[model samples]
Target: MKSQPSLDTSPKVSDEIRKTTCYMCACRCGINVHMKEGQVAYIEGNRDHPVNQGVLCAKGSAGIMQVNAPSRLRAPLKRVGPRGSGQFKEISWDEALDMAVGLLRPVREENPEKLAFFTGRDQSQSFTSFWAQNFGTPNYAAHGGFCSVNMAAAGIYTMGGAFWEFGQPDWDHTKLFMLFGVAEDHDSNPIKMGIGKIKARGAKVIGVNPIRSGYNAVADDWIGITPGTDGLFILALVHELLKAGKIDLDYLAQYTNAPVLVDAETGLLLRDGDGKQLVVDRVTGALTAFDQKGVRPDLRGTHSDGALTHRSVFQHMIERYLDPEYAPEAVSEKTGISAGKIRAIAAELARVAFEEAFELDQPWTDFRGERHEKMVGRPVSFHSMRGISAHSNGFQTCRALHILQILLGTVEVPGGFRFKPPYPKPSEIHPKPHCKVTPGAPLDGPHLGFVHGPEDLALKDDGSPARIDKAFTWENPMSAHGLMHMVISNAHAGDPYKIDTLFMYMANMSWNSSMNTSGVIDMLTDTDDSGNYVIPNIIYSDAYSSEMVAYADLVLPDTTYLERHDCISLLDRPICEADAAADAIRWPVIEPDRDVRGFQSVLCDLGARLNLPGFVNEDGSQKYDDYADYIVNHIRKPGIGPLAGFRGNGNKAGRGDVNPDQLDRYIQNGGFFVEHIPAGANYYKPWNMDYQNWAVGMGLYDSPQPYLFQLYVEPMRKFQRAAEGHGDRQPPNHLRARIKLTLDPLPIWYPPFEDSHV
Candidate 1:
């Protein structure tokens, strides 16, 4: 016992190591899996990863359990008893594929809308949506509607970027960081690291949430706000800031629509002949396009022509927020926040933003031909997520938070919130929702997207819902992610239309995913007088025997995260950092020990079996063997694909020809690739020409798409206009009043709909 038997202090953990991106959570952290005797021995975060940076969370470290869980579905199962009875017969992959094709082929051949396909939190949405498009189904979406569609839609519409997966607070430089309804589970690792960084630097942290737990518990200050009242509270802050002249007026004039003129009577943006938004030039006292060179926008400018008067959006904002109605005292009772507290917080924000402001030595050019000597900073930042976006007024509340950030000139600036690449691409460039389906042919375009107006609503010629979920209808006009939560219920009720099949991947609709779990279970299992299920044919795919599995007529078993090939594509939700545009790949570190296949790979086979255009070659042969093949070879555009790195002789960063060894390159590079944004283009992204050109070069945009922050979202007004008896595509009489009230272009707070019922 002289030296504890001369124990080896630095013991070897494994014989081999495999690098891949973790799917334990949405953070998509890069991890190193240790293999001992050809089995997973240990898991750790990759130190070289741009995200997490060697910091593995508990969930990520427990990935081995996920891969080897006893509950994982081993084989495809066919229902042998009533739906929800949990009685099933195992089937071979061949038979399962054949049965799926039998159920789906006819639907595609006759009416593809009869097949409602939706996925849940799947990383391969770009591929899944593409498959649905080729299959001609307008009834397709991801689980965003059940998650954070409100935040995503509002963020995209307001600032061309959103928080959570899209952007982050500048932890290194921000002196005061404010969080609204941010839960611990959301963006777990990066945010934890960020908070630690800021705390180490003696920065202040303010958390606003009804529950004083999670991130809020660690906050320097916590605002225990009332439920569903975040919009009112944020507006009160805006009101105080506007009243005290604490707003960044120069930033508003230069980077936001606050300087663009709006027609007072019509509540529409004033535009010139070419349809460009018009702003009043302060220097020349003349009306001109907002993007005109050398035009100094006048925040207080006004114009009149005969019967109509136009005012700057900023003036309208002042008139609306500075009014007594939005005062802290007015909203205090509703928000459950003291008037003094609101005022104090607003003052602190102003002090941190203006008084503690700093500047970077970097110089950059903006889109409007303006150059800056130094990058000016406001050391205040704010972020919010699903906590504030799961209510009746969620969209508006999200907008209000964004408006508050813009008012403080904190977004896309030094020591403020910064957008990751592929964002700051305005709504103008995003696709519109397309429900134009044809028999046996692909849909005209993508199924889910931003809806600009009543014209963009997914309604048929006869004025019925074009989608099974009733998204983009007058009832839910700006359903940017589609109503995935409504699909089963809507299909069962046949409210808008009936579907032949309810096909889903990973979404457990029969349980936790549904608002009324028992009701959804009944909807899934209930039979009509003819003894046929109300939903008719049900097909589902998941790696585990989740509650929804028992309800499916055909259950396709899927592979675990380690046994599948997946892409965090530039076209989908990328794992990007503020300083770099990044993407990662997940490959089979260990082969599945069961009959299950990756859901996406199965889709590839199904697409080929159905002869979906993109999935089949010119000779009608299957174009790709599996998801990995498609990721490497599929050309979305002339020089773009699912993975944006190591293309064309392993040299390209974004756009290039097919690289057969692309996956190998990614694996060699610790299972991820990152292209660092030039230092000069790091901040002030939306208006910076250097960033714009860099984004274009990276194929994030086809061209430099410099756009202003839409403080006054014009698209919402278009819907309001339709409700106000202006456009030909008008809302139903029953819904007109609600549309007009809720779709206000400017962010406004309203009581939760449940309150009215009570």
Candidate 2:
């Protein structure tokens, strides 16, 4: 949807070139902005950069228009007339900071829930989350909740790696690739680059989508399926593999919990007295340790530990999908794919997974003291994103795709789907959200984290939503990213609590960015009985005067991307590849001609004005001179900050003392730094001793213990148990059934809510 950069009529000339990161879109490609004696002449990609290496997208190349737009807000504006009237008067930064402090101080002192902080595609969540936590508010999130959190939650809970940014296919070595319902989005440049490499090497690519444009147009075989039926197709393929006995049993037993015993009565994994999960030994006909040195495990059988009858997790899984109803003929009508075609595709998958595997001549040792000279691989890979994630059944469908990959033994291996760096965070590693707020103190933890059970839910003692977004309630219990779309509607109706202010950054909540344009406009300007606005205050920051500028009660104008200092750190979505970890920053390439500030600088100023906990010194003096000073000095912990590279006394990367000249080092390194991960540590990362040691040493991962791929996630079972009224915290009666069905530990294939009745 981007228009191409126009051809300049005059011959392009350059006086000097400055390297920086691009922000026209979210890709954050590196660029060399050509300056012709004080103005930007042309911009091109930085070839040495890791992200877009010598190539820039249309949006990134069109940044000249963004900086020179005539409608850009040049100064702060305090609305002089009614809200949404497009009425404003320019003011100084001092008055703007005072206004913000006065409006937010009362909300922080009395009830922090009265303020909602959300942003649209905000890239600086590390600073924002800190700001919200220290400000004592539980309502804070970026835009992920309404975008693709379903894909992230499902993939992480299922396998400790996802199919998008957290992981990707080994595209260079893959013989066959399968893309499910993905369009021309999501890490766009990398995907396009990968596809180009695959096609050049004569690999076969298949796409499963309802639409056949964009990337699907290049697919060798495009199988059009009904929407929300991806799980059904995936399970039918699993059924075929089970019937033909074409599974990788050795791979499953070695890397997953396939041999772990599960009790039928309680629907939980059976463990010994020491709490180690037990597995049945085929040679001795007795229970043995899951990690027993020389025991061979039985993958398909029923065994009990005398207290109760039980079966292996693998046995229970096949029992669910091996039914006659899962055959291709049974699901043909629902998927709109004929039985013969479905069988052909399933047969192709089986052949590619088993018969067409490749091998590498690399030496490595697994965790069990076993030595292998070559790494075995299945030359098949997969990817899926927003198309599958924006549905009611998105989580389960994504889990099914992960299960399909695991069954083929294609996770984190050569020529298969691979985990990106900093992934394989312990499968159960997501932190719990801290919901409690206290006057004059920050919350106990971050506002957004994975909720382990009903106990972690951000609800009041009377079961009302504690935060305005209704994120971790029974309505959406597994929402790791707090829901942003529901914040406005929930606050307007006072569904849980009424709010005093809505502070947003880089979001256009008025036009195409939100739902029901007319209604949102009305809600922004609505008044209560006392002639006061229903939403008492509004604050927005944007570089340009988009449609959203007309609605803000206080307009804090922001400098353009080329005129700011920003960091894409490891804490959030930094550009890290499977082979190495990296992060970058954008220092001002040109001075701003307007009386504006970067949003981060403004947030820091607001923090100082309000005397928030971390923004001030012991003597009540400002801790940082500006955003750049904070980026260099602020420490999240003892030794970590924004950038992990070029830390200490100028000789180390990742986990070093904060150097006074950190930004200078980054600029000298061509606007970014990539840590060099050894070649042997790249593959089989969960069990790779070298990778684990390096990751933990770099502060990217917490522990050095080997991470087991979660073939069957157990946290889901706990929630289901709570729903069944057998745990310490039970769901309300209304959500009990919904929780019971969606919280199945195994990947399930059920129709999306609306499709069931249709």
Q: By TM-score, who's the top model here?
A: 1
The sequence of per-residue lDDT tens digits that candidate 2 reaches over residues 1-758 is: 99999987887589888888888777788899999888888889999999888788888789887679998889999999897788899999999988988899999888887889888776789888888888988889887887888888888787776866688788768878899988877577778888889989888889999989878999999999999898888889888888888888888887777888887877777778886677788878788776666766677646854876788889878988898778999999999988888888878877887898888888777665566688888888898888887778888888888888888888888888988777877545667777898976787788887766678888888887788888888888888888888877777787888899999887787532346778777777888899888888999899888777888888899888888998988878787888889888998988889999998898888887778888989988888778889888999877888888889986767788899999999988888989977877788887777788888888886677575566677778878988888866667798899889988988887789977677
Best by lDDT: 1
TM-score of each: 0.99, 0.95
After superposition, candidate 2 runs with Cα above 4 Å error? 1-12, 272-276, 281-297, 510-514, 754-758
Would you give me the overall lDDT of model 2? 0.83
| Global CA lDDT computed for model 1 | 0.92
> For each candidate, what is the lDDT?
0.92, 0.83
In candidate 2, what residue range of length 10 has the lowest lDDT sum? 506-515
TM-score, model 2 to reference? 0.95
The residue pairs that clash in candidate 2, if any, are none
